[model samples]
Target: MKRFLSGTVPRFTLTFFCLWLASLKLIAQENARKVIRNIEIERHDVFTDLNRKPRFIYSWANQLHIVTRENVIRQELLFKSGDEYDAEILEESERKLRSLSYFGEVTVVVKTEGEAFVDVLVTTQDQWSTIVAYVFEGGGGRTTFGGGIEEFNFLGLGKRIFSEITHEVSEGTQIQLRYTDPQLFSSRWTARGNFITGPFLKDYSVRIIRPFYALDTKWAYGFTGFARDQTRRFFANSREFDRFREEKEEFQVFGARAFGSRFHKRRVQLGYRFSTKDITAVPDRMVVPLPDDEVSHALILTATFENLSFVEETQIDKFVRVEDLALGNITQVSLGRTGIPFPNGVKRFELRVIRSEAHQIFDRQYLFLTLGVQTLFEKNTIASFRLRYYNKFARRQTLGINIEFDYADSLEDSQLLLGGDSGLRGYPARAFTGDKRLLLNVEDRIFSSVNILTVQLGGVLFFDAGNVWSEETSINLNDLNYSAGFGLRLGYVKSPDSRVGRIDFGWALNGGGFGIVVGVDQIFSVN
Candidate 1:
């Protein structure tokens, strides 16, 4: 009996549970449709459908098979029974459902129930989100491969469990594991933990966050504990590679208060952090001496404003797929101070800010801008801007133009660089370095309906130009490196908004070179 309970009983129990759910959905949908049809109601313009010959629409729902608890969906809904019908809210709820990545498609319908009331029905198609993905990339003077398995909605609770192993032929092998609970204990508190191990690197971190989404959740708080040990390679004075090793350990705690509703909230936060770093530098390829081992304890204060909106669909643009289009701006400002003692002794202060904005330019065109700035009170400052314009004309035809620029008064061993996998598609790995960098990219993405197995194929035509220069050097038009390429893309769209497996192949123009890469969305472009 014990053996049977352990084996056959569990399977039978799951089967029975699924059957029970299907039956419930069937009964509920039938009854709801009857209620909607029998209610005496005046005609509503919103509920009328001109596309259909009858003009009157009847609403129903189709529920897909899944283990997800119905309460999960109920909690995410922005409107409820007895509430006035709003098409915008219904569409917004559908977008949110799709964005969860658990559903392939979400459909919401509205029908008149009474003079001032409407009945709403939501239908969802579940996606196979338990992913076991493999990655293989090569050809750009480098080779890398890895695999990962993840469950984004573990136990139908919107939790995530992920594990991966990656190997770079020239570098080494790395293994990582991460777990996240967007909401714990059915509360707004979020928690995440991650660990990584490798021959030359190790990392571990645990964090908890209380977001300011609910009206009563004004006092948001977060805490994190982390440690890292890693070996890194860097170029000195625009020279060849040099090895550097670092060990970092830190802990932080923060709290915030929100001022408004979830849709339009501003926050003020304060935090304290303590950290220590140990460094080992190679003396041979040194352009400058490295900073000595040090410990830092600092207080940080920040203010952030958010006003973002989303649209379900747009007219004349067919490229609207699983995700909603974002429109609005988000900005944050932060100040930090590190000193011997809070009362008296002082060392240094830092300030940083960032902003991102998106807006519709024309019928099908959109513009996006992101800007960031960082400064150490007096010593140095760094600023960067990214501007993009794109048009989603159709499923197979899309155009985009992007400009990225960065400027820094100083250089650090572990700072941004211009070449390699990041831009400059045809440049060699880490081939350029300086205090200022600029890059421009233009691409025409063309997609195809060819699906081999679960993989969808696409292609792109691209052009890239970029340069990096130091304070002693001036920007020159002739100094810009040029590359043009054609690319192949492979995508596995098992989930609506989740990017499971993506690979890209790029070939440069003028016989410059060619490379292939794999990333979360498209390839990393490592030529």
Candidate 2:
């Protein structure tokens, strides 16, 4: 190869290309794709980086089998049996499971095996939890404190359920119930049954959400669905209670997502979704003054492109992304919610954030363009930072700072905030937000399990700080209002992460001993 390059190119060019190819392409090939049937992994070869990322290697090292139904993978596992080719199947399963943060431990066992005909045993870690959780809200002469019982494994059938009740001095009682089946149709889909009736959305909302994922030779795609129904009196009317009436609203939504990543060069994340209500059958008067029925149907769509470059020789990571191209420069919208009644929420922010990380605006002939530059940075950190100036003619302008951090690239204390309820644990699930506000959470976590099986206990010290401000107030960063205190978090995490999470018990100090709070899903993270 060296001889050929030398003769085919100028001496200087050949030298430069060779070095470039070695530093970049050498590391790239370490993650290049392979035919599924090739590069089999044994216990000793489990950690090999060839054809796989390091995380997959760590997951595969603990892998067991590949559970499938009708040729579709149901879940990934981390256990093995003497009768099955556990190593191989587990590796493939890890590829699918990592995309989702809803499982604790997912393993496929060989139920009954003979020759090439193997019956896969799908086993999931149980999530049975007993939790007392709480929340409080009051900005305009109203404040409430409440808590409830939340559980993960309702009946040992891998089904999850959570029920909670809370109260405020004058507001009222809040009750919620929820259940979900991670594998609704065995593979490629999920469903949830939710019920809620409270002072705010003072209505019962029952909705089903399903997500489908698949992959071809090149890219992968996923789809999700959300449908809900709301009842009347979902809100409080200061004057009515004796003869308060009720109304109902039903709606449905569908969303699609697609992603593609090559060896180690670039990654493309894109998707679109549209939702509308079928309120034709409802009576006009049955609708409350402002209900889902009275709301307009809308559609949301977004697309993003990102490129990554790794200079292994120097161990630096440089990548850039541009998200939510549908509405350029829309920096203040959030859409990750299934029924938040907004178009392109999380998606648009995702695109803009991507661009902010991996791209920069450049001009050369009086025309400005966003150039995504991929290069190595200090200490080999995988960084996506964006520096942008609005004007095409002037270099002096307002700068937008957007940077995303990934611990997978960390070389040290990075992992300190990577595990358990550490970073963003203020209000589990990163739920602290405000306009021109400050969000902060400090948790000192101590975990002790009852012999690693029957039970697990965790104690936490937390400081939750942040506040919401109306447009009427003058904004000041130095004078950001915040609340500080400590709390305890206990988990009934049976099949945590790759397993299935059932109950998340969170109670913090809201100026008192313990304020009960409940969190949904298994992935309770902040970073």
Candidate 3:
């Protein structure tokens, strides 16, 4: 027995020692591959050089704009000195920086120093962060005019401050104040607050969150509260028929934990929500009954799956700007229940499922699809589907198509509307109201190489068709409305937001006459 024990112990000890040596060697190799030696950051102002025409004006503009702080850019990076060197991580860092509206250009370059060391260089160009201008939007004979001042990068930090005063046809004059800090207190947390007041409404909201800013983020949490008191107006054929006063308060808090790698991830979240709503009908103009008042307290659980894949393109949404499109799949499912007995002895339950998928159908064509379903058991249900397709068939040109459908069961006081403001550009706003809606939009977008005083230009020819039906009416293609239009686009290249302004003219085929639509940004989004 002693002889056998001695032989077995020696063999086992030698094997274990060899395995440990192998593990140590493997770890050393991994460290050699991942070690980063130094990082350099270069920040440029709105104008890197003043050698072009209007040099004096460009110089003055650059002097007026404050370049972003080095720390602000450094804080957003996912890797730093002594961290692992990963190409995907570097690309993700570039994307993160580019996503910020304040940065007009971002690039990350890496140089291998030795077998175990690499140097990274990050470069960024700033945009004009302060905007002071008049905002005007007119469509279907209705016009909303306003002016606002916004500073997207306040004091060289990634903060936003905005104040605006606007006059709308339905709600009269309104004043709004908003502030946001993407990196609150130089940390990952974000904070935002908004207050709006008008003759017919008062609203306020506050949100604080430490979100999953990266795919490998392990935990996240957030809190949001909102309150609003407003006069809700119902319109038909662009005419107000009924109005009510609604007061609502909502509060929600959630925490999530993520698991998996950067390429594929899963997140599980738990949340609690409390909300109350009350309605009062107008005394002399009560054409419709008021919605029922209710209070709810619920607990919710949600699971999410995200497959991370992206494609970078230019001239798709904004001219001369880089845009990243997610070409992966995302799915989420949520379940909620108000299981506790209330004063009214009523219980409620809710379920929501959302899925989105994107595909590269061809070399230059992409398609995106989204589906959503939500239900409050025994109360109401809503189902919506959207499809967006884009073909970059030629340089500086794209063909974009969008299709959307929505259906609601047991709709109460609310209405599903379609009109000039909602993709059916020929008719007035709220010209069609129903429980089901279908809309299709096609655009041949042509981005010009012309730049007039730093402003890029583009044009679009579009066709729109849509129909809406009440629950009592059956769906019919013959009842569809049609509109054709052409528009001009102006891309503000120097602005921090890179805003695109559009003006469109439409001719209605179904009795509605000519219409003009003016707005900011692209009319539709793929997501």
Query: What TM-score does candidate 1 get on C-alpha atoms?
Result: 0.78
How many clashes does each candidate structure show, in the order listed? 0, 29, 0
- Tell me which of candidates 2 and 3 scores higher on TM-score: 3
Clashing pairs in 3: none
TM-score of 3: 0.92
Whole-model alpha-carbon lDDT for candidate 1: 0.67
Candidate 1 regions off by >4 Å?
A: 1-66, 78-92, 108-120, 214-219, 236-240, 260-264, 282-287, 313-320, 340-346, 378-380, 496-511, 523-527
- The lDDT for every candidate, in the order shown, is 0.67, 0.34, 0.88
TM-score to true structure, per model:
0.78, 0.42, 0.92
Judged by lDDT relative to the true structure, which candidate is superior, 1 or 2? 1
lDDT, candidate 3, 63-140, per-residue tens: 888899999999999998988788888899999999999998899888546667889999999999999979798887
Q: Cα deviation of 21 in candidate 2 (Å)?
A: 28
Candidate 3: segments with Cα more than 4 A from true spot = 1-31, 340-346
The better candidate by TM-score, 1 or 3, is 3
Candidate 2 structure quality by residue, lDDT tens digits, 1-527: 87876674678787898999898876765444322221212222112233444465435433432212222223323232333354344434544543332233434434554434345554332222334456543222234567766544333233456777778666578787777766665543566766777664444444344432322223334444444443322212122211123343444454444345432222233334444433322344432222122333333343444343211100000001001111122121212323234533222121123342222234311111232322113221222322222221222111111112221122211111111132222233213221222334433334334323323443434444333232244545554323333333333333323221222233333322222333332222211
Model 3, 265: alpha-carbon shift in Å?
1.1
